[model samples]
Target: MNKKLKNLVKESYNNGQLDQETVVYIAARLSRKDLKHYISLLKQEEAKHEVLVTSAEKLSSEDVGKIQKLYPGMNVIHSVDKSMINGVRIVENNKEYEINLNRTFHDIIGFLSTHD
Candidate 1:
């Protein structure tokens, strides 16, 4: 979990040369606690960056394409959530971008309440 170890893991993973020998070489250096932490970090590092596009209904090809273009080299996953009513919510890198009917309604209600 130190910077150097994290960088080494990232570099090894990115290099696509993280074979068994490389794993053992790193594993051999760590204590049990560090080994567990290293494994956790490795799993996180190896996970593909994902973009979750949730909407009330399936999006058009054009919309999906636009999102894909926005996030090249990352996975784009789409899911339907009827409660969204309409519009889309995008999740990328732990950040959320939403423009949806539910959000709009909530905002309107909040504004009306504050002014009332």
Candidate 2:
């Protein structure tokens, strides 16, 4: 029964209309503890992180290749954001790695402020 419920939830989620109200109603009808457990499993499945590489300009294939080699199995998405100034930023899951001129300038300003 729990397996069937999980499949139903997953199906609804995939179909793109699984709203909070629907989930709340479903949980109200089901055992709260079991529903929570199933939801945790579903979240874990959804937690497959995608790597996003943002830079000031479009990245070359070699740059993307290096990121792929670094992350191995994760999906990589690249986009150009001119605000980065120069260099790249990598975001995976909730963590961000900024290696750019803009970031360096900010760091320097922060250091100067602290020292003053």
Candidate 3:
């Protein structure tokens, strides 16, 4: 993680939002990583948007990459969503993903987050 991101996580940790173990995990997970490390910024942005991602969503590292790629400026928290067919439901930038397919895409959470 870069200085800015490291600081943000520190701030969140200080605020008691993020835990130390998670911090250590993040540092180790993002070690020697560029794009993966940038996900911290995206995660921080999600907190700002009031969208929670721990209500049963299962976000994988690959899914995180996919969400970041689809909405580069948005932070997505993955969980087990039982409502959508298969896709992300994002709630960021005051706008949502415009996915209109009906093939059970696994990116609905990226959209549901917006509706909420």
Estimate TM-scores for all models: 0.73, 0.57, 0.30
lDDT of 2 by residue, 18-113 (tens): 467666766777687878876875565454447888999998899899999998877799999897799988888778888998879999999999
For model 3, the superposed segments whose C-alpha errors exceed 4 Å read: 1-57, 69-75, 98-116
lDDT of each: 0.82, 0.78, 0.54
Report the lDDT tens digits of candidate 1 across residue range 9-87: 7755534545677788888988998888888777666454778899999889999999999999878999999998999
Query: For candidate 2, what is the lDDT?
Result: 0.78
Q: Rank order by TM-score, top first?
A: 1, 2, 3
Candidate 1, poorest ten consecutive residues by summed lDDT: 10-19
Supply candidate 1's per-residue lDDT for 93. 70
How many pairs of residues in model 3 come into backbone collision? 24
What TM-score does candidate 1 get on C-alpha atoms?
A: 0.73
* Clash-forming residue pairs, model 2: none
Candidate 3 lDDT (Cα, 0 to 1): 0.54
lDDT of 3 by residue, 1-116 (tens): 37867665555464445566666665665545654665657575446645323222467788667656765544465555545534555655555553323333435766777787
Which 10 residues in a row give candidate 3 its minimum summed lDDT? Answer: 97-106
